[model samples]
Target chain A: MSPRQFDQRHPHPRPDDDSAPPPAGSGAQARDTEVDSLLEEIDDVLETNAESFVRGFVQKGGQ
Target chain B: MGVVTVRRVMGIETEYGLLGVGNPAANPMVMSAQLITAYANEGMPGSARARWDYQDEDPLRDARGFRLDRAEADPSLLTDDPQRPAPEGDLHRVTLRRRPGPQPEPATVANVILPNGARYYVDHAHPEYSSPEVTTPRDAVLWDRAGEQVLLRSSRLLAQIAGMPEIALYKNNTDGKGASYGTHENYLVERAVPFEDIVAALTPFLVTRPVICGAGRVGRGQRSEAGGYQLSQRADFIEAEVGLETTLRRPIINTRDEPHAESSRYRRLHVIVGDANQLEVSTYLKVGTTALLLWLLERRGLPMELAALRLADPVRAAQEVSHDLTLTRRLDLEDGRRMTALEIQRTYCEVLTEAVQHAAGGEAAAPDPAAEQTADVLARWADVLTRLGDDPASCAREVEWVAKLRVLEAMRRRDGLGWDAPRLAALDLQWSDLRPERSIYSRLVAADAVERLVSEDEVAAAVLHPPQDTRAYFRGEAVRRYPGAVAAASWDAIIFDIDGAPALQRVPMTDPLRGTRAHVGELLDAHPDPGTLLATLTARPPGPQT
Candidate 1:
């Protein structure tokens, strides 16, 4: 996923661009934007350190 | 009541394996009875014999068009008993104080809805722990872990009771005797979205998911060829793309069209394809990614490309993904394209990213909480896929199958045995055993070899408290405050005999987001008793039903 516009806390933050949308509620906007940056770090490690996701495991019978 | 909450009320029901008992001749039925009795006998504060209402259940009503046979519709028949009461009283306290005698066998399925808005019950001869409704994947992990804690504590307590050998629980699907239980997931989807659309979209995604989140298996073929290790334990068991029966003719997309939310507004997607993951990371990713895909399908109609993503034969693809650990197995897609499981999974991830970006790019896109969750899912999904694409062993910490494979591979090399060795199969069973000391997964978690998503503190907190954002808040509070008054409780409504009223009052929680902390906290506080609370709640206008 491409890095998007976010404040210091939220990395892939919600779209804060809409000042006041008629249909959407403001309850969701209140949460802290702290989950994305950590995901970015995990993203980096998984990209490099964590290797293949489906290797080393095989069926019990000869395939 | 937000823009995307119809997709947020999610929960998981896991049937745990009972081991460590039946030494000389430990009957599972007898052992299950003991474990169920242990919890019921040692009743917690919110414990009562609150009846489980089965009025809304209609499993036979397929998401497609026709109603299945009555036998197929009644999923609760597996655990239903009208006389069974909720676990109440201070049995745990009494058991601790006195010399525990032979525990009485429970007459019916011991269904105890915990204070944390989750249900702990014995179903189909297994102690099943169902997590409370949660808004996101992260909460799903925390609450799911809380269910594990429930199993662990109950198992430990059973060990203490005399005449009862220690009980062991495993968060796995299969019992290795060809009989498989389920790790069923329920997700709220817009009822407006066609059920056929859901099956078409989810079939391929569910089939390929084992490549990333599968709990590795040691043996092959549930009732067929049994020599090779498969990627997932549940794969060989799923025989069709869509079906109403979970026990017989288990399908990839379960048609248990029992929408726990309001029928007109929301439909519950009963996902049966997933494996019960031991790794917290795998659990998080499994739930998070699936929720995102569902949201994408619900908000925007199922894309044509997604339909094109379907496998030529879904059952074959599901099994192939498990058997082919090299990530090189190619599935014939609906578009006549043969794609590897890794490729198909990555494509889903890529589409998820594109969809999120597309939504964000919209002009009046509000600051949605789902955006934050979607971000979490996207990053984790990408990370796991990258690791899986690289050298599957590297993901040993986060991916459950990899971690178990590493343990088994090391043992096999040390013993100089083949994968088909019976000892290796035993080791595989030992890996999932929930006994803290004996469980290899527990050992891995202790040694910091497995990646954990939620903290133990979060799990503990969830065990005692319901989430503040869903109808679970009200269900939990009602049970907590009026254990004696609660006549029955179901997903969408609660039947309570408030103030000893002759007739039971039905409190309908049609909107999953309405009876939340923000919506009903003050109301709950104002009316300290069940009688007053029901009167006040009913008097209030039907506002914000969304």
Candidate 2:
């Protein structure tokens, strides 16, 4: 299948800037930033070492 | 007439479809990942208020049970959405990072809950929520039902894409015989207690859950030491050895001992023996009944009666339970109360009836009432057992066979194995240890891949649209693998087939044992089609081998 077709099926494309409004409160905003950072790190880790990360996770009972 | 103290304790986790392997076919994992991404993008909206039964702790509570709203509101981990969509309802967007290669259409859909205070993602593959703990069982039901609806809604987009296989969540541990599976559950224990008492009190109940929840399996003809035969809770023993050690090796009760709390006393009993029950009644009973049992064991301090009442040989008892279902074993308790299995069922009902009554009332009482269906199902299951308990010759093979088929199909259609790659990987996982000819199975997979590549054909298309009479083609191929399997010289005894190739010969199925290497070669020689072999061997759908 073409890349675009696969994307159409799963649709995890990067978030466009105007897609969602900011967090409700400043506290919520800060927490979202933290989550965003962690998500970024997770993406990096998954992209860099997909197989080993999965293997390690499984070995650790998928915790 | 008195102060009704309602304890608020509840938690929930929903394991979603995860797709690490990439396939275009609507694999649950692929579709789930995609949905999650979409939900995330849409800004997970927090429901206005928690469900009445969702027993989330007041974010205001402090160490001394005082309000903490002044100092700091406990930062919300999840966006609380009371009106989440049904499993078949609306869609949500989740975001996934772009990969380096030509990115396949966002291969994952996640419902984005960007810093929402209500519902949020728990893990990459699983979604979880800790409802405000509730005092009444009635309330817990709402949270459970709500969670189910949310999962169903979140899963709709993916399910539709993947041919909408009816999906279910298990609330028990393993398929009785040998396999270990998930039994998702939640509980509200005291926030101040020792882990020792927790393990001591819960271990026995956790270990023996299979007794009530185990779907019965046929006993392989080999007699046990107590002269009782055993079969796996799973239907086919062709790919798995049905035996006592097998059950013991992969235990139903797992204790990683990781308490998901800051303090030791607060531990949610995480159970995993659940089968994916199809019937709504079975699922309701699966969770509601087991939760009641745990509630009783934890609060009432019921000692492990089944273990003590256990037959001289467990394998025998297991076999008897599997075979006749009604043969009652007597369990003698510490209080000099000697009860047969039937009596225990009666007493269990009385206790649960009273317990629920007391909980319904504000009075402290001895024993707990049987949850709604536990008593009736136990009695009926026992009756079925008793009716057939005396007969050794009369076979209700058809009923048992149907039950086995139901279990088999339910297992095969789980959300996790929705994709071709993982489904195939799962078969490989199941057969890793039991392959008759390890090298030969591996070689066939390798050959299939090469053949497909050489033909420039896609395996998915191959499965959805086959080249010929699938069953006969597979059968012929399988027969070819066992050229010398059955020797004409030994018409009665099995002859060893060494070279794995097709042989047109019939072998008696009654042989007690056959040489392993030779059998493997012979079986492979039969040249059975991969599809048929997978279906018969794994009780699963055949998928692409990559």
B211-242, model 2: which lDDT tens digit per residue? 33343332233211122212223222112111
Q: What is the TM-score of chain B alone in each candidate?
A: 0.90, 0.39
TM-score winner: 1
Fnat values, one per model, are: 0.00, 0.00
Cα lDDT tens digits for candidate 1, B414-506 = 557787665556556657767666566766665455666666777788877888889888888777777777767777667777554546666
True contacts kept of 1: 0.00
For model 1, the superposed segments whose C-alpha errors exceed 4 Å read A1-63, B1-7, B20-24, B71-109, B362-369, B541-546
Report lDDT (Cα) of residue B289, candidate 1.
Answer: 86
Query: What TM-score does chain B of candidate 2 reach?
Result: 0.39
